[model samples]
Target: MKKFIGLMVIGLTALMVLSGCGDQKEQETSSGTKETLTVMASGVKNGTQGVFLEQFKQMVEKEYPELTVETTLLPDDQYLTALKSKLSTGQAPDLFLVQPKKASANSVEELAKAGYLEDLSDLENWDKIKDQGKNDMSFEGKPYALSSSISVLGTWYNKDLFKQHKIDLPTNWQAFLAACETLKQAGVTPIVMGDKDSFMIQFGMYQVAANQVYPSNPQFDDQLYTGETKLTDDVWVKTVTMYNELYKKGYVTDKSLGLGQPQAQQSFVDQEAAMIFDGDFSLTAIENDNFDLGFMAMPANEEGETYLSAATGAGYAISKKSQHKETLKAVFNKMTDGQSEMFTNWLATATSFTTYAEGDDLNPVFEEIVPAFEAGRSFYWSNQAWPSGTETEMQAKFSEMIGAGKLKPIDVTEAMQKKFEELTK
Candidate 1:
């Protein structure tokens, strides 16, 4: 009887082990194989692109349960270079952010032409994307990227400082200079700028360009592309000369050459300057200090009306070589939904006008430019029509002009034209 009981116990133990193995196999099958989706983007974690990525990751992981989403956020300069290297090495991330066609190095059209970006025409939300956004990200009639929002380039000012000085916001180029002079006399930095990030030059110049170049010759970009116009033309020269006035008058912060975007933004937030030329993307950083701030169009030609420099913000695209594109598409559909919290957080952080059908309510500072947008008195960023690396070249030339103090605006304009001509050839 004792021997029989021992055998029975051993049999029971084996059966229990087999049952446990069966249960483990069932669990593994139910959970499915895990896949990781990698995303790379430009901007800080608290910035628009970062917020969008985080929200998407959460929404996607929650919805898919078996997918892991990983992201890397880099500064604009580094991000473009890194993405290019990754693409060349055949190790591109599943999803990466890119600017619209003709905007930057990692632009949608450039990447699509290189056969790196995937065609997103079949996306469920493709029709829902605003026409402007679609057009910006499309190449050869195929959409490739998802624009987060639209932003305006303008002058952001400390409202309290203006109010204390009893200064009315300038509505014309002369008035703008006068306001800067007044601020200077009051011992205030008239404009905060970070020239180290030469692209910041565009923030100030595009507004002027919109007023100077686009209003009369709306076909300037088309003409330039077709070799009928040049950056050295009277309109471009006027734009550059007018924009250089701020630098010439010592209105820009002396430390601008050494300052980066973060430092410059901090200076503005700390009220070291009365105004800063920036885009709506910087609004979150400005507002965090709870300083009463206001925004205005760059008073280009003084029509006493705003002419905005507006464009669709940089967006995300899937790599054509990605193995997990279907998964990414699903995640993107959920994240880009106008009704989703993902988009809401993005809008709040970005403070830019949304391209969604149901847009977020505008903050009062942004409300000032709404009329321009409504009146369709806005011009897209001129860089959007420029060739790759041309903006960088312009920045370098302009920086040299500003730094060396002998290189005139004409020199910068001619150099830019040469670079543009070279790229076109």
Candidate 2:
């Protein structure tokens, strides 16, 4: 009986030891906790948005050792579809990109209305974001996203090439044509066009329209939307005509319609062409070269004045249903704290100005046009007000017009007007 009692006591002691070990393991597991966050960003995997996310993830992991961040970077079209699908299914990422209000497919206003995005009105970072950016991403007067940057569209040229040919920078449309003619005479392509992507044509056309169309009638878009005016109006035709002049005068490349954006950009970089119409975003690929580059607002009118196409670019928004809001908020705070390394890294590669406080010195390429933005000599791209698919339709119709070469500019404008009417109807 004493031996049996001894065995019972030892068994009890062994059981206690096993139980204690189990508890220790549980405590360690609980103490070493981790949270994960996912983000859906637009652009190619190696593009700006992708690079931003990569840096952001490293910063977050370093700052919050218990957190892990993962991002799925996709091209624009795929990103839009994925973002909408996830939002509608209540599986949205913890953070996602939101384009300005009225932007096609991923409009912040629409997302906010659907209760899929958090209201960032109370975020302390609001003090850092530009007021125009806040207003651009707001819904019902409440901020819904954090604008990353502002992009401007203009004429980017090779300075050395211009100097070599003694081509003075033109300030008026006529002089711009003269410069192009001189460059052509020197056996240089005046403009490298990527009309294979119709949107490329709009890069220049819209800048022209900013000066030729909006200054005369700032409310023209509103009137056109209300059907009180038509694209057949004189201002629009002039804008279209001004845009086509580059092609009509043989200043653009001979195989412009066959060339893609990469090819055209490369042509300019290789000194095969003197100029190309593109946004500040092109600077990513441009900054690597040793060429002396300069940017100028498109010279479209007779007054020798230039106008820029400026607008708020993409921004970030927190998911209303995210389970990791605090973690995401912390990341955002660190990113915009101004003194953080994230800010510096972002400023270094950005093609445009950050909407958050003044970034590091503007890229030298924008030296000539920075004054235009500062002086309020810029206009928002007109398509910003249109509903989804309208601009895409216009781009397609414009491409067709380029091919037919028979449709008057007014006819092209009329087709755009008709599509707008039908789509909105």
Candidate 3:
């Protein structure tokens, strides 16, 4: 009887020890007394996204003394592959950057569809996001990411050069061409394009489409999805023709097809060119202390009818496989509070307009087009609504048009429509 009791006690003690170990494992998986929340994104360590992540880590660590935030930033070329690989293998970080809509492989819509992103609609501060931003970050009526900034696509011109040439900012297609002629006659390259970097083609083309396509038919992309309309429609042909006209007129820099984006940006900053069409993201690359820079909506329409190409900036998304989901949610909630130090620091790092109401002060370079954005005379980036590869198709066909001079605008649109059908199907 004494031996039996002693054996029972030993067994009970072992059971208690095993139970304690299980509890410790559970706590470690969740937000334990000491846990790490990992973050990954694509950008330079000191770039806007890097600053945003550093601020986020500081805020999270300060708020939750027991938690540490670890961040890793990769260049754009490697990020998507690494993220997709990590996600497919169930090794994704707690949080990562995701583009709005189906803009990229790591876009909110794509990742949410693949079950890699958490459904963030239930977040406490979800409603604080701007309606347009909400739409961009949502897939099938459910939010998957948080976008704090709004990116605008337009023309960045040398203010000092414009002042020296006594040329006024153009407000319409006709006036814009006249201004280009003026610059050309003055022996200045009116516009510079890095067509060698095929994606740069969209910077100008999408701005033109914003005015020529969406203003009249806001549901154009939806119509395409439902077979109600096609990219080969006359509107797209017109948009392409207008964009081609710039190349045909020799208004753009000579042999632009041979130059990459960095070269084109360098030319603009060196005062060899008067203007370059780009998005707000390029401000850091194009801005020069030697001259004041000015940005404006591409005057692709008639007077008083130009449309701005703008959309929600890419932002953080929580991984569905993250063990620290609750902690990540708390961090995101704090960020959207508007009164938090995190929110203020985020607004300060914004290179473009912010989606939050507290972000009222516009960047001086973008001041010229603030009215258009405020007046709702703007459209989201066209490719954001389409599948990822559609823009690549457009770029390739358009490059054929510009380089080989073999494909017409109609031909380019036909190819784009075909590629769009294949991708969506």
**Top candidate by TM-score:** 3
**Superposed Cα RMSD, model 3:** 12.2
TM-score of decoy 3: 0.87
Give the alpha carbon lDDT tens digit for every residue of 1-425 in model 2. Answer: 00000000001111111111112221223658766768777765465665556766765555455567787877667777888889888899988777777766777777888899887766667778777777888999988876556777888898988999998989898899999999999999999978886668778878988898888778887787788777678887888888887888889887888997878888888888889998887776655465788888878878946888887776778899887665455545545567656445444444566676664377677888877777778887766766767677667766776777877688778877777788678
Which scores greater on lDDT, model 1 or model 2? Answer: 1
List clashing residue pairs in candidate 1: none
lDDT tens digits by residue: candidate 1, 264-366:
9899988999888888767666775556889888888766576899887777788998877765565456545566554444344335576665555887778
Compared with the true structure, the alpha-carbon lDDT of candidate 1 equals: 0.75
lDDT of 3 by residue, 1-425 (tens): 00000000001111111111112242353534677778887776656666556666765565455557788777765887898889989999998888887787777888988899888877887777788878888989998887667788889998888889898988899988988998999999999988887778989998999999998899999899999989999999999999999888889987888998879999999998999987777777887797988999889996567889988778778889887776556656655677756555545544677767654676677888888888989998888888888888899999989888889999999999999999988
**Candidate models: Cα lDDT each:** 0.75, 0.71, 0.78
Task: Estimate the lDDT of model 3.
Answer: 0.78
Descending-lDDT candidate ranking: 3, 1, 2
- Each prediction's TM-score against the native? 0.87, 0.87, 0.87
